[model samples]
Target: MDNIVIKQPRLYTPLQIGLGSFVGGPIAMVYLLWQNFKTLGNQNGTQYTLAGGILFNVGLLLLLPQLPSNFPSIVIPFVYSLTALSIAATWQMRRDAIQHSVHYRFQPNWRVLLLSISLLIVWLGCAYGLGIWLDALGIIDLDGSAITAGKDELSF
Candidate 1:
């Protein structure tokens, strides 16, 4: 046992700050994960993010279709956590690969890539709340009914 060493597993990463804040949704998450896989594959592939991506896709497949506009309050946090988990796990794998001298850089399109990713992040973050807020503001009719029909009413 003297030659054996145990490593404590880390569950989160600083990457979650940007990822969760901006790309913390099903579609953007999957795209980011795909980028991760493609980038890492060019260097040294890691199956961890692939599995996470699969899980995210599967979740999207099953839960996305059935989700109502008014999802549970808990769902946002849950999905954010899942998104954070994926980014954190993949970042860890990427760090490991880079430490081992795996070099993979897709040059010549960095500007386009940056602009697109920035647009995507902003679009996603804004879109997530826009519809709900619009509905809340009565600018959009969700089946022609008031969402807050009884929200402020006191029941006896």
Candidate 2:
């Protein structure tokens, strides 16, 4: 009898994260980070992947809401667009691993996923809350109304 090798789908990648970030928001990137933490350890470019994930988040939480909300909100999509560069960097780090057979059919670890997501929720909350606190304390206003004299306006 001959042994068989079955190829499986690639579940997550920087490109995947980059694209998913647009459609799925931070949750998708979090999933990729969780996958990275589980499968790879301090691999070359791991920092970039992690940084990409974090930056994706911060860009959304800290920078996106400035867009006027009266119409289709481009904040999330726009932020994700810029952050994709960070995620792309990680693709190099993951190249070998992604091509390996081991990663193809491996079972995703649930504990790591839960941990990543929980930490993300707390981290995002704190970071976002800090922004709100700064606005409240008059340190810097992120509401986009400051420039328009307290009225949110759509502008190019």
Per-residue lDDT for 10 in model 2?
A: 42
TM-score on alpha carbons, each prediction: 0.37, 0.46
lDDT string, candidate 2, 24-129, tens digits: 4575555564565545453544565567667766665765445565757766565654465365454423444565756453334453355445655665676678
Segments in model 2 whose C-alpha atoms lie over 4 Å from true places:
1-24, 27-31, 37-42, 74-104, 108-120, 139-156
Task: Quote the positional error of residue 85 for candidate 1 in Å.
Answer: 3.9
Candidate 1: lDDT over CA atoms? 0.48
Which candidate wins on lDDT? 2
Model 1, residue pairs in steric clash: none
User: What's each prediction's clash count?
Assistant: 0, 0
Tens-digit lDDT track of model 1 for 48-151: 55576567545544444356868775665466546555664645354444335434322223433463467456545655455566567876655544446555
